[model samples]
Target: MTAGFALSPTALGDGFRIESFTEVGSTNQVALERAGQGDPGKIWLVTGHQTGGRGRRGRPWDGRPGNLAATLLLRPKVELATAASLGFVAALGLRDALQAVMPSRSVSIVPDGGDLRGGGRFALKWPNDVLADGAKVSGILLETAQGGRDGLAVAIGIGVNVVDHPRDTPYPATDLSAMGAGCSASDLFFALSDAFVDNLRLWQDGRGMSAVRDKWLQGATGLGSQIAVDLGGRIVRGVFETIDSDCHLVVRGQDGEETRIAAGDVHFGAVASARNFKAEAR
Candidate 1:
C-alpha cells in the first residue's frame, strides 16, 4: 500500500486482493507481467502515480499525482470476445463508485433520454469512458494475453482523476475534487473494487451482457443525438443509437443506414460536427 493512502480490506469485499505502489510505469503492464508469471487472477495493481500509463488507441494517459491508476487481473473461462465485455463492466463499476463517493446531492441521476449537460451527473461514454458533467473523469482499458492458469489473462486498466486532471485534450477532462467530491485515491479505489465485484457477478462471463447493456444505456452519453465516429481512415456521422447485444455501438446514419462500429473514437455535439467537416475536407 502507498503511504497515506491504504486500501481498506473490509471495503474491498471478498475474492479480491490488491498490490499497491507509490509509483509504477503502468499498472496494466505490471499486471500482465505478473499474469505471465502464473499469478492467479482477482488481484488489483494500484498506484497513486503512474509514469507510463496508456489509453485506447495507444494514446498516452497521464496519471497525475494524487489520481487513481489501477488494473485488475482476471482469468476467465470465457472466450476473448466475451472477456472483452469486461470493459463495460468496468465502466459501470466506475459509475457506481463515483456515485458512492460523491455526495448524494452532488449527483444528478439522468434518465435514458434526459439532458446530460447538467453538472455533477456521471455518465458513461461509449466503449469505455466515464463522463462527469459532459467532461471525461475516467477511462478504462482492457488488454488480453495468453497466460494464467486458464490460458487467458485479462487486465482491466482504469484511471480516475481525483485531485487534478489534464486540461489540454481532445475532450474536456475534470477530477472529483474539482467537482466538489471530497475523496482521496484510496477512498475511490475501495468503492471501485467493490463495485467491480458486483458488476462482474452480473456480467457472468458475458451470458448476462444484455442486462449489463441495459443498465449501461441508462446513463450513456449522446444517445439519440447526432455524433461522429472516427474510424481511423474515415468518419461516420449519424444518430447515436443504442449498442447492440454484442456491445458494439449502433449508429443510424443520415442516409437511413445503420452502421455497427466495433471500435472507434466517438465525438458528440459540436465536436462531432467539427470532425465530420474535417473528414469532408480531406
Candidate 2:
C-alpha cells in the first residue's frame, strides 16, 4: 500500500499490472472490475490499510489498520476444478516468502510447525489459512468472477497479520506484533508478489498439486487431531484424517464413519483443549 517500486512487480512479463493504494474498500472488488474491462493476464492491488475486506462464505474480514491485505487477479487457462487449486499454490509461495523475511522467527515451513505465535509457531493450515499453534495468523479468500463474454477472472485475496488483527471477529486471530515478530507491510508485499508469480508458473506448467498437497500435509497441525467442521448449517465433529488429492478433508466421525469435507469452517474443537493448548493465545 505504501508507495514502493521495490515492492510492486515491474517485471511480470506481459500478464500483469499493479495498482497499489494506501487504503481501499476492497482490492478484490477493484481488481474484478478491471478484469471485466478486458484486463489481460495478472493484476495486483495491495493496500497498506483496508477499510472493508471479506472472506469465504461471506465472512467479514475486518480491514484493520496494519495488516497485509492484497488481491491478485488473473485469468488462468484451466478447468474450474483445477484452477481452484491455485489457492494452494499461493500458499506454497507465501510460506517461502514469510520464511525469507523473518529468518529468526520460530516457524517451521514445510514440516511440523511448533507454534503459531509471533514468529515461533507459524505454520500453514490446510486449504487457506496460516496459524500459530491453533490460532489463525493469516486467511485467504479466492473468488472466481466471470467477464461475461470473455473468460474467467480469478481473484486471490490474502489477509496477513502484519501488525494488528481484528479484535471483534468471531474466530481467533494474531498479528506480527502479537507474536512478537517484526515485519513491514512493504517488505512482506514485495516478497509475496515475487512468490505468487513463481507459484502461478508452477501451476501453469502442470506440476500437479502433488507437491503442494505433500507440503500442506507435512505442516498440517490437526491431522489425526479432533476437529469440528462447520459446513453451512451442519456441524460435524470428527478427527481429521488426511487431505486427499481432491483437496477434500477425509475425516473420521465419532460413529466410526468416514466423511469427506470439500468445504467448511475448521476449528481444533473443544474450548477446554484449545485453551489448555493456548490455541487462541488471546
Candidate that would win on lDDT: 1
Candidate 2 lDDT over 80-100, as tens digits, reads 787788777877777767766
Residue 222 of model 1, lDDT score: 71
Q: After superposition, how far is residue 27 of candidate 1 from its true place, in Å?
A: 0.3
- Model 2 ranges with Cα > 4 A deviation: 5-15, 104-120, 205-207, 271-282
Residue 257 in candidate 1, Cα distance off native in Å: 1.5
lDDT of 1 by residue, 1-282 (tens): 334544446435566778899999999999999999998888999998999999987989999988999999999989998999999999999999899998433354332223453224788888888888677789899999998345899999999999999987755778999999889998898888878878988898888999999989986877787777778878888898889999999999878899999898877766566634554423
Looking at model 2, residue 32 earns an lDDT score of: 85
TM-score of 1: 0.90
- Residue 182 lDDT in model 2? 71
